[model samples]
Target: MTDALDRIRSIALLLPEVEERVSHGQPTFFVAGKQFAQFRDDHHGDGRVAVCVRTSGMDEQAMLLDAAPDTYSRPAYLGPSGWVAVNVAADDVDWALVEDRVARSWELAAPARLLEAGGR
Candidate 1:
């Protein structure tokens, strides 16, 4: 869980104007005051350590869930809103995939002005 959090923090903070805060008892990443991703550690005792991130929409969410059932899941509270919970704690976790998802989530949450500023 600690390693997963460290990896998420490293990727999330590289985006422009991103910040981390404790929201809903988990580490959450935000851009321009809007949430982009959250790090969950056995949230609600569900026995999963994952990173919950917003997708482009339900279509993308469903595609991800269908394509990689082992890596992605519809998170509890955020699922209705097209969010994906990525299993980052797996031993074979792909850091590149996680980085891509984090970047995409940041893009979804970033405002136009911030987006124009570009990410790192």
Candidate 2:
């Protein structure tokens, strides 16, 4: 759990203007005052450790859930808002994909100026 949280912290903090805060008992990442990612460990006793991130929309969320049902799931609270939880506690976890998701979420939450500045 610590490893997953640490990795998420490292990845999320690398983005421009990103900040970390505890929300709902988990570490959440924000950019430009908008939440982008959250590190979840057994959230609500679901017994899953995941990094929840915002997608482009419901279509992307459905696609991800369809593509990798084992690796991805629609999180409880954020699921209705087009957020997908990527399981990072698995032995075969792909850090690159996690980083990509984090970057994409940051882009979604970041302001236009930050996007223009670029580089996560």
Candidate 3:
């Protein structure tokens, strides 16, 4: 695994019921069998290492992309579904922000009981 993938795995696995599996040639994180996060490496020649996660909605996706175009983007194949991508390979990447987003994604996909347990 690359450093970016390692970092994502470390943070993503901390959430309750989070599982890592390879999906579409990328490392994907699932909560209660629902995909919450996916680490993409040069996806279809995009030349980026990113973690795609679920956003609250299209508004959130637009807000994030507008706020930080360098760090956030509309992920391919999943963008229409309200998933946004964070550029994890950028030199100015903010890992804390990534963690926060990943946690939110986990909460979005996790079951009600798992979420009620604090999702830690």
RMSD of each: 0.8, 0.7, 1.0
- Kindly list the per-residue Cα lDDT of model 1 for residues 8-70, writing each as its tens digit: 999999889998999999999999899999999999999999999999999999999999999
Q: Is candidate 2 or candidate 3 better by lDDT?
A: 2
Q: Kindly report which residue stretches of model 1 are placed more than 4 angstroms away from their true locations once superposed.
A: none
Task: Give every collision pair in model 1.
Answer: none
lDDT by residue (tens digit), candidate 3, 1-120: 299999999999988878899999889999889999999998999987899999999999999999999999899998999999999998878889999999999888889998677666
What's the TM for model 2?
0.97
TM-score: the better of candidates 1 and 3: 1
RMSD of 1: 0.8
Worst 10 residues of 3 by lDDT: 111-120
lDDT of each: 0.93, 0.94, 0.91
Ranking by lDDT: 2, 1, 3
Q: Kindly provide the TM-score of model 3 when superposed on the true structure, using C-alpha atoms.
A: 0.96
